[model samples]
Target chain A: MTDVSHRDAGLLRVDTDECKGCGLCIEACPPKVIRMDESLNPYGYRTARYAGAGCTGCGICFLVCPEPGAITVLRAARPRQSTAPGQQARP
Target chain B: MSSEPEVTWEIASSKPASFYSTYERKDELQHATHYCPGCGHGIIHKMLAQAIDELSIQDRTVLISPVGCSVFAYYYFDVGNVQAAHGRAPAVATAVKRSRPGSIVISYQGDGDLSAIGSAEILHAANRGEPITVIFVNNAIYSMTGGQMAPTTLLGQTSTTSPRGRSAAHEGYPLHVSELLATLEAPVYIERVGLGDNKQVAQAARAVRRALENQVRGLGFSLVEILSPCPTIWKMSPVESQRWVRDVMEKTFPLGVLRDHTQAAQSEAVPIPPPPLSMIPGIVGVADAGLPAEMTGDADVPALDLQVRVAGFGGQGVLLLGEVLAEAGLDAGLEVSWLPSYGPEMRSGTSNCHVRLSREPIDSPLVTHPDVLVAMNEPSLRKFCSTVHPGGWILYNGEASPEDCDCRGVHVLARPFTQIANNLGDARAANMVMLGALLEIAGNLPQSSVDSALGRLVRNPKWLALDETALVCGRRLMREARAEVSHAG
Candidate 1:
């Protein structure tokens, strides 16, 4: 239950330790945002690693990855609210 | 002075889109008022609209519509869309995609627009792995032009060009465009389905979504080759065409994910980051098999035209072996087309591949005349030994001595193909072993380049050495022959 982070510049991101490497994250990333490392984890599979910075961050990969609590993303930072004068002037 | 030039015009519905309107999903893109009844174009248009909406690419989307019913997709998507020339969606999409990498580009084409005139455009586009999605619709004949034989037409499907069943002796079988496209790795996803039945509809949706998703990921090429029904031409009503596409087209084209990026992601166990579209030109060599060698044809001495066939039971790896030769030719810059023929009976019956190599674009897939043919069993020999051209070479695999094929105009070598395969450990390595012999007698391939090419296929050094050894042995045994007709002279 970490924040739904959008890593790779809001494309994709995941926590490496929780990854069981079942490839659910890989299968879910449509643009192939997840990749496997060469070293196999305890499950003997090279776990899915965050692939690239091009991810559009549609949240499909985050939703479909079967491993629970494996992937996390830092929310895209939002700017603070504008002042009333700026808002009223439609700036 | 308000100068006015007299002009009068009237535009009607052209042909009411009753069929399209009926099939329209109310929840999606309501009141989309363009397209005609019994038009394959509209289905693709709707699918694209739904995909854009679901994927939310609408805000950053660009649709390249060619001169077909789909040109009106712009009317529905409410996003920027351009109508390109006839069969030039790839070129147009190429420009749009390169200029605006953030926008999702969709190229929609019909049979004539894609397979016939613009074949080269799409091939080179996919070959380059442009970050674009192509929706190729095959409806057998060209409905827009009053029905002519398109490159994707089935063997028996009658079109204007072939009033009689498409004679393989002439027109040949329908082009398995998806199968051909699968050979290239640049495309991150490729799938084929028929829109005739409910099952195929669901499968098509999955494929479309998969392709669209790949785009969202910024993966390279994604295409969904759909076999839609053109009732206006096939002498069938819209419903009948749908049924025919379901029963017949699906049987021939078979519905499935030809190449699933997601599956590749699974097996790969980790995601490989795809480079940006800006670097595509510099990254062409980054494909699975790196850029091929330079093949300037033998100009001083022309090479003999050859048709090569590799045949065996389904699991025999015969096709892979043939691909090595084709890639070798590709390296040599020789024209090549690899074709396979099969029904429900693949393993139990005869399974063969057709490879035609020339100095020019291949006009036909059927190898009417083969200069060299490989038969891995008695059944293949029985079927194709007669088809070999007079003075052609035949390679067969037999446990003991050579079996008499009793055909004319060709020389047959019945070697212990299985025994050699056993020595290699991996029986599938037999195909590569067979390739060695094929290159030897045919002289169509450079053995060194082929060895280099095959190296990319097998990773295990032990297995790799065995294939090389088998190739060397077969190369040594090849019966030498004098050049007949060379392309140069």
Candidate 2:
């Protein structure tokens, strides 16, 4: 819901040490690029991590994050190339 | 270089990033807050932080957190944080706002804190239209104190104290805080919002912002009552708690704007300014009088600073005597204070007052060792005679001073002050008679100031005439007693 969608293209990084695996961020992400990793964080709860290259750089995960500074979304300038081959990716 | 252009966006918290909690947890906790998962306080904190960031008021914002779950709000909100006593946030906030009127003071309180113990403080502060914002969180039960029955606990709701369902006959009805505060005239904005769903949460956010906005605009007394979810105590899942708030809690406390007087209040002119301090003497009817010659702070009379204690039965005008002395001292341009203490009984019970007069500002109103003791009866004389300072004077209203009482270095002026007042046809004027004798014995005032003070105090013309005659008789009796002592010597 924040203005991070202005660029329409970005990457995400979640701090494994700070994420409680609350999954609120996962529920909020429109692209579903965020997922709780199988590997346990230092405190033992599964930490959230970027799943694939489909991240739209939308900061919904950051806004819904209870832990401040846990999620960082870096947005890119132009339209991103899709991981899929041959088929035209819809915007 | 055949690549997509760089968007260049970084989601580092928010700009009031300073407003968010980047706390380094001692225990390495993952969450920014200590509140349990799905607690509405976390959401409310987020909304408030966003509002503060948007308004750019983080520097001037002062959050007063009282006891209960939000007691550790200082750790979350990175503003001027103040921890108030369990139920005294409104009072503390009042002083803070009044002293630093530029600052935005917010009193954050819970149901148990605001409704039960702090009811009077909030009511009076809101009634006075103090320019402060209050964020009241009603979670139905006392969550912090192990989920006890709160004033806002709904009927049929069970808490630790209300083991069974809350009964109307025994427990009474729930207190609608938003409705109660809305009844007050001073509050410019009042709303009750819930955090049940996204729609409700959005409405709550707006209410919080509007409440703070009213404060920013110098509007008086705004409060936003947030019906938050206490999932841990409610023994429900976080999602279930949300449903409970929406389906169940909303029935008891409906979500809506209860009142909004902001536009009307802002257009109205400010109230009249307070009168100047120089006008007080005139207002109290003491400006026209000429102070006695001896009271002009002369070197010959010596600076008179008297701490006098008057003690007697409740109905004997003991406090009245102290008041007259204090008023006369003020009329003579001296610093004065009068403090009274009495038992519960209205009459015949013990009563006392301490009166202090000083050329300089008085330090304290209490007189543990009085320079003068005016004992209205034999029991009062015996009780207080020992505490008189050495070389102090005691004016006792008896046939004769108690011979066995150890007055030591204290001088005694035992006389029938009441009998003299009775002779003047009013026994109640005895206190005025005693005042006359005390002033004459102290040899400070010219009796005119005392008369003016009596004129200011008493309203009836006939009683005022009788009191004037009584003062003359008291001064004459003091003169006669001095003469008798000199003759014997």
Candidate 3:
């Protein structure tokens, strides 16, 4: 099994200013790595929050979230060690 | 939080570059959209923007936004935007794509817009096989105008209009748009996708992208129908509304590709570019007849404003007189407007026309108070003589001006113009005689402009010669009348 504790796969950031606290991302997240904040933002709705770990960055949350800039997903770069003999790393 | 080594991160998905960084639709909500929480338009807009960004066509993309909650789409998209009237997006998109083949035109419409009022526009555009992409968002209800039943509203669904839930016997069955469009032969791609779940959303994004790609390849008539959720209108939580779209809406409108002729379809022929603006007059056979050099430039001309109203019986060329005056004004590089009002009967029915010519732009074609009035008969004289402005001129086609008629401070040129024209060989040329008197009074339109306008309008050479003689006789009579008035004074 893959190591779930390692933070190597992906990271998620939620722009609270733009999020409407729809919770669509929380429900659609495959790893269940997103949650609703305990307190509401200035718009008076509890916004989505990234759970500190276990994000695979499949971008399902980004696709399902209605807000354009609310959810942004970042995937970890592939390790150089996995490259073949003479294959240069992509910029 | 121990790690062997830190891994670098790259952005996988964010806001598309095609979207404006800040929506200027409203003052307060610059960073957010006008859509309600969990509205499908936001997601759909993102998908469309992403497609435009990927194809690198943002510069040439022209989005025809329909009348709906998305009418303000221009405020968000950083591309060419046109807001079409309710349901006319397809018609507007066809015109845009045909006129500008280089543009990537998209018609974004909702269920009520596409299927209800704009049914004919969408049908004919698709029948013609226009090369454009259409994004049809079906929420089964008119969410923007409150929860009202739409053409695509499913049976047993309650709305403001269908309070008892739609009954098949009463409201009829829901429209299956994708299936209906797939029956047509011209469409190259037609698909129905939803935003009910993660998988569905992924498919919808791919479908949206593919529709745009098909348009880029010159394939004809691609549409993607999205089964979206209206959480506010449905009175359900955002997540519950999403579930309803998957469970209930999907049963009525199945999710899948209904038509896919993209592989077999050939690219459409390149549209012929329209002729240059300067060549249009030549192509229409109006070139080089005798358009003056002044017609091309108005800067050197003196300021002039003339308003004339001509009224007579239907057969009396009253409208033709007005047309000649306006056409002469145009040939003299003046702004002109001609508006004709007449009765139904063509021969003896009363007819009148208003003409305005000015060095500056004419505001309106309507002339309520004219500076000059050409009354061809006693009835026309009595009807319009009072409406003439003070210090204006009145040309009455009679042997003598009526004593009861008010001609105070207004110059009156009363003559038997019809008798003069009859002597000149054609009584029908009376209108031209009155026009000649009018030109003498105005003194702005050159004789050359008037002659060319007459030559272009009057085809038969026999009548043309009679009209020319009548015009010269009318001018001589006007000069004599003015000289007699000066002597009497």
Candidate 4:
């Protein structure tokens, strides 16, 4: 069975194999969180990759991506606070 | 190292859902298109496919692909597809949409197909206000046929034909299709868009959708002219091609809605009602005279099937001779067919016609090997003499039969038909003289029928009299030849 790995990260994942390295997305990203990787994908064109952090999940990069399904954005969810037995939970 | 799943939103991709599962041209590359990377066709095709999907007219859609780089469009679009001849997409689309009014017809054309060979087709189709959508892709060069100079080739642009760069004095300026069509009164919507930057691509997508939508709304003709990028032909990288379209092409062709007569077009879209079949005879001025007596079948006439080929130079009335024979055969109650062909030169060009008359239902209108060859000139006689069937007749309009044309099992009557007509007072009656000679020899149709047909065709009494005399002289000549043969035997 194919594994569906779940992760919590406020970041953008580039399907490096599908990218053409047109760099339009790099220009479109307001926070400048995307960059072309030095290593080429299987197709030989240098593909885009997400920087370590600073992604606002604005999705402008996805909006400007000429190739469909090449980039996906995952937003960081609000952290859950652990509630003890005697602790009053804040609304 | 395990973490909770993160919430994410999926943005719509540029590829449309309406694209076929795999391009028919290549089954292995399902995700890949045939177009080169960064080609604007891929983007334009995506925009069109998105529009088709958004409108949900995939079932009712018909895409007409002409001869061009996008000729393979049918392989990608999951809809009814029709491939048209080079520069004939608009004409084929017009017929398709007119016959199937409920369907959505899209004529996709390139600069070469639209502006060059098919200019008249597109212009007339738009002028007629045919309810169809035309997606004109302007790439400034003919990419499909090896980057030849197209009508829309920009000045100073180099191509295979314009290797030294196009000069304004030599190649003229690029054609503004949207502006040209806007000058016409009937077109409902005309817009020019570009597949340049992201913003321009978005606008081009909207324009494509609007043009298709206008057809859906039953509005009149709509065209979306897109300035697309041809990276391979332009010898530029994909990104550079897009940039060139934005920075360079836009300077020549500004993007905007040239005209939008949507509301006015709606009123004109009412389908023209066809006249009743009963009114056809009246419209053609034959209501009083019903189907010719021959067609009504008052037979007892001999079983006759005649095929006649008439050929001559342009001003010689060759087609008229065939028409007269065909008309007389019709009057004689025989099924008749006449087909005429002429060269491009209006005067002094070769002209020819084939006529068939048969008691039985005619098989083919074309007479491949005619039974009777009436050559009104020496060239036609020499050219077609070999094609006549054995034991057939050759009536050449010359002084004497050419040497080496003494083919056995054939009768050749070489006479100066023009001189004979001149003796009869009008050289124009030469065709009539040849017809009379043919009728006298064949006797397939009665002389009275030929006379009546001539009367119907020739309204001028003076020419008719001269033709009648020419016909008699021709009959006499045939009789004299037969008598001389009998005397010699």
Candidate 5:
């Protein structure tokens, strides 16, 4: 239960433009969720990568990365509020 | 405003101002971090940003991130930042602040990056009073490379390199860098703080802020040397590591200010007012821009008049003798240099020294070949016996009597250094005894100069001062044997 409070576990994003071929993220992820691609980015790094639902978004990938702006973690969207303030529709 | 610490955390009374990401939320705020959970780096990063926001110097500040665990410092700080070469932040910061005098530069460095390869760079920059702020995170061991023994590792502290805890008599004691830099007149602020508790962490934050404030005031060379924790490398929980730094490490490295000019109104080291940025030299060539030696102004180090190498085991005082010889030569108005080969291979491995003594200028201090070889072990004799200059001496440890036939044409002295030290009762004295014998045989020091040099060295009354021991032992070794008479046909 305490794990849910971890500030770093969130939705993830990627900054492809700054990504280098260095796959430190793929290596660091505990879930084995990310992989590299043959296609290269503008920086000539085989900079493309992909991730899956296995990404619990620990952000260790974001942390261990050498390249800045390469990894992003986006939080899950909040549910929209009802028309009435402080109210929710019945289940 | 200087030393008083600010609050660490505050829950939103309502909500943080719009467009300003909340410090705790995991949404857009997540973009601010690229760090592992439970990593102590997170705490440091947050503190730096908080201090920046509080001070409102974000626009003018320039952060320097060197290659290390903290290399991604540019990511979190919403300011201009440049990446520096590995172990070159101090040098890079030195250049940046000089180039853009209006811009405040801050160097964020780690133990290995700052104190290992970049030691001299840091010393020289601080010595020159460079107007830059340096945040040195000393985690006792290197974190970026897993864990290696950093120069500041405490004696008996374990690391990857020192699996058997560092030995004080071998790896030597932890370097007190803040204390060392405080000795220099260049730095205006110096402090060492740790983050073991709420109080200590708050103090660490304040130390960093004090350095930043000094930069805003145009003070030269402000440094906050933080004793940070690398829980992953330290093999402890974050809490335990914090306790370790606060408790165990703090025993050796006490908290509080090492030096702070802001505390007092007047100090001997007032910040030198900035010169017009236009007048300052830039990255490119600018000759005669060399401050007259009058500024760095000291008598130039003369050229090496003699070159010697001392090779021995880890326990032997081989390196100390080499440094002492270099200091003595320097005292005698001769240019001198001493280089000891001590890398990952220092213990139970090949150990040697390259000392160059010159009458003119010494360009390169490394002795690829030796004029004299002071060998205290079989390896030293076998390796360096061939390199000695013709008609020069090889001072081999007399206890190990290797046949002279193996080293043909090389003058050899099987001097009993250990036996001499036995007379002295400290086994370590053999190195001094060997050095003393060399002085008698080498004749590099003129009779008049040798006594003056020896007298200057020993008058300190400090027994076992390496240089003094070298001098006395050198004299005694000469006395033990008659000076080899020069033979002429």
Candidate 6:
């Protein structure tokens, strides 16, 4: 079990209202952390949900998802100390 | 514990900016698209929108949505949208791209619409190397109008139209569109991708972007054919349908880049802009003669409305006589139209023409009932005499009018005009003599207009002189005939 305070390298958000519950994202997630919810959405179909841990954030789920807004992937920012001297900051 | 650095998350992937915030295609589903739950069009649309957003060309992009399920593509895409007829997306895209050369035009089509109905259009567009992008979605079967067989359907696939599972002898083999198009010389890029799994989806996204990028760079034609899955129509779960594409569909259509001439291809030639309205007359070699003085608000000029039907054998200048009449009407500042009907044979075949000269704008060129019938032969006279209007004049070329023709209330001037032309110089001038008599009866067009029209049409000076003499003789014949009738009365 992962500690609640520990931040993983990646995070994922699944909008229940926009999800059609096709399970493509769940099947495509490399970490196998996404699952179909037991409850139905407003349109009466099961929706995908993040399992709260072990996300690598490769963004394959976002690529395979049919709905544009259903899946959003986020990657953890690198530590400030690891920044190279001549490297430009991301905008 | 205090030494650990705090970590924050930033968005890696989200919805693209090219899609509308809310789809207003229907009242109920404002937030959702019209596609089925696991439909491939949604995924493809997202990839396309992402490309448009990344390229920063959303404002100048024109998406030509074709018939089939994706006909409502305009509802989702925020770019300039045009819904084309089934299978005509490529042709429509060509026109749009040529007219608005700066705009990025994309033709989105389906298997039934592209490979089946619009095969010729796509072939020609690609062959010409039209600087446009084509996104072809092939799902093997037609899903929009129920699951019917498509041109790209796999050989053993069972569709509503192919209930017994398509056989080679019955339906023939599946069409390889990417390969077929690659054989053409003009296309700069052609690739086939699939949406069966994550890897394929990622590759498809890259191909879609590259196809659009080629258009942005002004490279020649580029096409990306996507083998998409239809879950509902295939009667399989979404996952199983996708698996079918990878396992079964891939065997029939191997995925790869079929053609890549983008590196060697130069930017296509800029299309010539259409001429301005003022230059059209000069370009077409028509003198910009505005309406004549007599045509504008003149109360004394009779309201000229003449419908003339001229018919004869093919070599008897049937069409030329009609052309001269229409040209003279133009010179005289009247609205004119001439329609010719003839057989395939160049000579000795039947030919006819309808000529209309009206003061008002002519509605149609067809003259079902003419004010006068000029028949240069016996068969033509018998055929067209009944169609002349009541009290109209019939100028027949024979010695006398046919006894069986029901020329009840119409006036008949039956003269051997061919023999008269033979005495003058050539029998071919008989049409000119008939035209002269007809002009004398109408009395609307001036002799100067006819002379100018004849000068513009007749190239040989010898034939022109003989035709002029024939015309004077014809006028004399008509005058003498009228005098004799008055004396007999």
Q: Choose the strongest candidate by TM-score.
A: 3
RMSD of 5: 17.2
TM-score of chain A of each: 0.60, 0.74, 0.78, 0.73, 0.65, 0.78
lDDT of 3 by residue, B1-489 (tens): 443555677899999999999987534669988787888998999999999999999999999999877888888899999999999999999988988998999999999999999888988888788999999999999887778899999999999999999999999999988898888889999999999998899899999999999999998999999999889889988899999999999999999999999999999877996877899989999886875445343575546699999999888899999999998888887889999976421113578999999987777999989999999998888888889999998999998888898878899998898988888888899999999889888786788888998889999999888778877887887788889989999
Q: Residues B326-380, candidate 6, lDDT per residue (tens digit)? A: 9988888888999997642111357899999988778899998999999999888
RMSD in Å for all candidates: 26.4, 19.4, 19.5, 17.9, 17.2, 21.5
Predicted complex 3: DockQ? 0.43
Q: Which stretches of candidate 2 lie over 4 Å from their true place?
A: A1-13, A23-34, A47-91, B12-15, B20-31, B267-489
Task: Please give the DockQ score of every candidate, comma-separated.
Answer: 0.01, 0.13, 0.43, 0.07, 0.05, 0.37
Q: Please, what are the lDDT tens digits per residue for candidate 5 over residues B1-489?
A: 334232222221111121124222222334334443235566566566656766787787888997776776665566888999888898888777866777778899888888888888889998997878898888888876668898999889988899999998779889888899999986788999876665666677788787887777776678988887776688875556767888898988888888877654232343345666566665345734665353222355432367798998776877867876777777767777899974231112456789888776678988866777889887778777878887677888865447653666666677677776766655667877777777665555654555455555556544446444555775666654454533321
For all candidates in order, the CA lDDT equals 0.65, 0.78, 0.87, 0.80, 0.67, 0.87
Query: Per-residue lDDT tens digits of candidate 1, residues B229-275?
Result: 76656777555666788789877787777776654532212234456
Q: Can you write out model 4's per-residue Cα lDDT over B223-259, one digit (the tens) per residue?
A: 9999988877899876688789999989988989999
Error of 1 at B303 (Å): 59
Superior by lDDT: candidate 2 or candidate 6: 6
Best-to-worst DockQ order? 3, 6, 2, 4, 5, 1
Worst 10 residues of 5 chain B by lDDT: B10-19
TM-score (all chains, Cα) for each model: 0.41, 0.55, 0.63, 0.56, 0.45, 0.62
Instruction: Give the least accurate 10-residue stretch of model 1 chain B, judged by summed lDDT.
Output: B10-19
List, residue by residue over A10-91, the lDDT tens digit for candidate 2: 6677777766666666755666667779999776778788865666655555655555456777766545544344222222
Q: Model 1, which residues run further than 4 Å from truth?
A: A1-91, B1-34, B263-489
Cα deviation at B321, candidate 5, in Å, is 46
Q: By TM-score, highest first, what's the ranking?
A: 3, 6, 4, 2, 5, 1
Scored by DockQ, the top model is: 3
Candidate 5: segments with Cα more than 4 A from true spot: A1-91, B1-32, B263-489
